[model samples]
Target: MHDPIWQAEKKKILTRLSIAIYKMTDEQLISLLHLFKDLNLKDNDKLLEMPHSHADGVVAARDRQLLIARFFLLINQLSEADLLKFMNRYEQKRFSMLREYPRVPCNITLDLAADGRAINCSAMDISAGGMFVESCESFTMNQPVSICFSLAEDQLALKIKGRVIRLEQGGIGIQYESLTKYQIEIMKNMIDRLQRQASSQYRIG
Candidate 1:
């Protein structure tokens, strides 16, 4: 029952899926894993009864197996560090206080626009939710600001709108507003790279 055409089509689907998965944020990937688990737990009769193009039970079962296999294969390809980071983030989301996401230490210079002027600032640390900017300029709480910065790794430019949530001696905490999925994905990737670099340096020392 080996069909070359079906195998070719499956390969194409998996290739596209891999690209999409790579671009997904950690939360999206975790959600997809949950979905795959639910699908795997479903009975064959239930799967066959579901709305799908395949009318034959055998084809439906084969498709389910292929789907699960492809997803796990991609998951398996992730490095041990990457997998550990994902799980750590998952646990942080469930139990961490104050901050909902983990922050990665960085020293990226950026432009901050507020009060009709652009001031140069440097980010001390960044998380998916926000960042702390080190600047001498005074910013009042809840003041709106626009930030533009490029990640060092890929030079990916990001312009984000945020508000000053906390004022400190030399810096202000900024909480990002209405972040798009794409922006979150880029931020997550940058954080992952920074974290991995930090870990390597720590071990070296």
Candidate 2:
């Protein structure tokens, strides 16, 4: 049994680490999560295989590697249950911070594929991180969904995967799966254009 005072301190540290992880860039966070998923706490050699960051400078990359190494070392000290608890806390922190991304209204029709079936839905709004689709179709929470849509007049279609995160009275919120750099850039450009258009319309009214 852990001492009461020690347990409190452990919880505090885990919370702080979770918050810090939440503040990392999406790519970094994704990499960290992947590493954790495949990690074997008993295998110290895995720590040496940490991926090097593509950060600009050598110093930056080295610093990031060191940080990740320390994080792994700390995890090695945790019991399986403690590690699970930490992961849960990290996920909670991540979802709570996702709404910080800017969202804009959109009206793009898209197809949602799940469980060997496809449902037609329209995007109500979108952000870099996720989108909300207006659909009467029922979807389970955390259900994996494949989304395919094209922007107006755009010949290229965007195919992305996401998970159902929230179910509203009339719609469902989808958080995108790990996006590639190109996908991230495309979403940012689209959001910028929509925001500018919205601003123009507001001024005209």
Candidate 3:
């Protein structure tokens, strides 16, 4: 019941499935991806009664291999139209709008507690999640860093704790960590209003 080989084989099957889907025409590709999705969602429904193993404890490994190869060949031609429809439906539901927020050049100071390094950087963008500060130096990934940045004036300045989630050529990605209830409330209201305006514009377009 606790066989590692079976797990490896299953992984191989899924990998093959992904490769196959990427190779199909748009319509055929959509159908193949849908099959996997259905398998995940309707496993208990017994849609396709495919035999997994023989009575003699022998797996039909050869047949499964051929089927995997064929699936890959068919998936090579999936249509872009079908791909866009699927993506739009999924992404739009998850994110209310796909608009990028307007970013103005602003100077911000960052103090990293790990090294006691103080650096001045320009902000690339700002959203409720966090802001991207343009810097050439890379910070430790997943490192907790203290950031004290002023916006507009000292009245709207933010002193927040954040974690560095990613590092890239331009700058590091930060996710905000520390904030008082009042700060969070203010940010949420601002973000909701901005997103609503963006969503309205998206609909008009």
* lDDT, model 1: 0.67
Instruction: Assess every candidate by TM-score.
Output: 0.53, 0.64, 0.40
lDDT of 2 by residue, 40-145 (tens): 5455565534454444312244555466556757665877576667667666655754654588998989998989998998999999888999998888998899
- Error (Å) of candidate 3 at residue 112 is 5.6
Give me candidate 3's TM-score against the actual structure.
0.40
- Residue 102 in model 3: lDDT: 34
- Alpha-carbon local distance difference test for all models: 0.67, 0.73, 0.51
Ranking by TM-score: 2, 1, 3
Instruction: Give model 2's clash tally.
Output: 0
- 52-163 in candidate 1: lDDT tens per residue? 3232212243544454455656444444444445445544543552354589889999999999999988999999878999999988988999999988646767998888
- 1 or 3, greater by lDDT: 1
Higher-ranked by TM-score: 2 or 3: 2
Clashes of 3: 14
Best of the candidates, TM-score: 2
Strongest candidate by lDDT: 2
C-alpha displacement of 109 in model 1, angstroms? 0.6
